[model samples]
Target: MTLSFFQKFWSVLANDIMAVISSFFHLGQLLTAINHTFISLIPKIPNPSLVSHYRPISLCNTLYKQILDNVMIAHDYLHFLNGKHKGNNRLMAIKLDMSKAYDKIE
Candidate 1:
C-alpha cells in the first residue's frame, strides 16, 4: 500500500514538529546549566569589577553557542530527511493557465 500526498506531508510535518520540540527541551537544559555555572561563580569572585565585565561576556558566549548548536541540529535534520527521500524516484509537475478566466462588467 502506498500513502497519498497528504499523508506524506502530514507525516513529514509531524517529524519536523517533534524535532523542534526536542531541540527546545535541549536548549532549556543548556540555559539551566549556564545559570548554575554563573551562580557558582558568584561566590568565588571577590572583586566587583571582575564580576561585572565577565558575567555579561559569559552569558553572551553561552547564548551564541546555543543558537549555533540549534541551527546546526536543524540543518542536519533537514539534510537527513532529504537524503532519506532521495532514493525514491518521484516527479511532481504542475501547470496552471488562467486566460480570460475572470470578467467584470460595469
Candidate 2:
C-alpha cells in the first residue's frame, strides 16, 4: 500500500517480493470501519462542453470489488459477448420511450 513498493517493483526485475508477503495475515470482515467512497469526474478533454465528456470513477474496498465481480459473473451479464452458444429462437426488444428512462429508475 506504500508508494515505495510500486516504485521499487517497476525499477528492478529480480526484486524479491516474498519479504513483503511473509508477514501477511487473514483480513477478516470489520463492519465498524466506515467504507470510503468518492466519485471523480475525469474529463475527456481540457475543455468539456457536454456531460458525455465526463467519466465517473468509483473506488471502494478490494474485497468489495471481488464480491461484486463474482455477482456479475453469476448473472451472465455478458453472456452474449461470446458466440460459442447458439440460440434457438430470435430475441426481440420493443422500446416504447427511452428518452425519459432515468425519470423513474427506482
Q: Scored by CA lDDT, what does every candidate get?
A: 0.46, 0.49
The runs of at least 3 residues in candidate 2 whose Cα sits more than 4 Å from the true structure, single-residue gaps closed, are 1-29, 32-34, 67-106
Clashing pairs in 2: none
TM-scores of the candidates in the order shown: 0.24, 0.32
What does each candidate score in C-alpha RMSD? Answer: 24.0, 11.3
Cα lDDT tens digits, model 2, 1-106, are 2334445675462243333233232344344322555566778788998988877756554333455566588456445444334576544334356446522211
Q: How far is candidate 1 from the true structure (C-alpha RMSD, Å)?
A: 24.0
Q: After best superposition, candidate 2 residue 98: deviation in angstroms?
A: 21
| Model 1 lDDT at residue 105 | 21
Best candidate per TM-score, number? 2
Compute the lDDT for candidate 2: 0.49
Candidate no. 1 TM-score: 0.24
